[model samples]
Target: MDFEKLIVWQRSKCLAVDVYRKFARCGDLGFKDQITRSALSVPSNIAEGMERYSDKEKVRFLWIAKASCGELRTQIIIAREIAYIAEPLAEKWITDTRELSKMLCGLINKISD
Candidate 1:
């Protein structure tokens, strides 16, 4: 599969945009930067990995992106606890991450298989 064409990449891009949009306008500079960085890492790693010449590299980058997703999950939990993010929005983001992570893993499996 073309990693660039993967739905997870598209969703991760959206997720990054959402993270930036939500936090960029906020007054908390620290949280905003951290969360946005983690979110941006997801798709950025995917794109970087796709530019590689090997499937192993692509999978490695996808795993890196997946790890970024985990970081994003943590940031979401913190943002929720501190009331930086609304519960509904946090829930939806977490749900999206969970689903996308699963699908990305599947895509990796398909590529390796």
Candidate 2:
């Protein structure tokens, strides 16, 4: 599979961009920075893992990316608590994370298969 051409990567890149733009105006620099980092990690790790020559390594990194997704999921909830975005937008982020997680799982299974 051309991992670089994966739709998940494309959506993740978009999610990272959305995250940066969403937090860009926030006064809470510390929280914003951490959230952005977590958001960016999702796609970056996926791409990095996919580029590896080994399925074991790729799956390992995908697991790591899945963990990062969990962290981002938590951060998004907290952000919603602090009113970082509206209910609908925060819910959308949650949904996106869930979908991305599923996609990662599917990729890992494909590697295993």
Q: Write the per-residue lDDT of candidate 2 for residues 49-89, one digit (tens) a residue.
A: 99999999999999998899999999999999988888998
* lDDT of all predictions: 0.88, 0.91
Per-residue lDDT over 20-103 for candidate 1, one digit per residue giving the tens place of the 0 to 100 score:
888878898888889999999999998888788888988898899888999999999999999999999999999988877897
Which portions of model 2 miss their true places by more than 4 Å? none
Deviation from native of the Cα of residue 46 in model 1, angstroms: 1.1
Scored by lDDT, model 1 comes in at 0.88
- Candidate 2's displacement at residue 39, Å, is 0.4
Question: TM-scores of the models, in the given order?
Answer: 0.93, 0.96
Error of 2 at 80 (Å): 0.4
As for candidate 1, its clashing pairs are none
Q: Report the lDDT of model 1 for residue 79.
A: 94
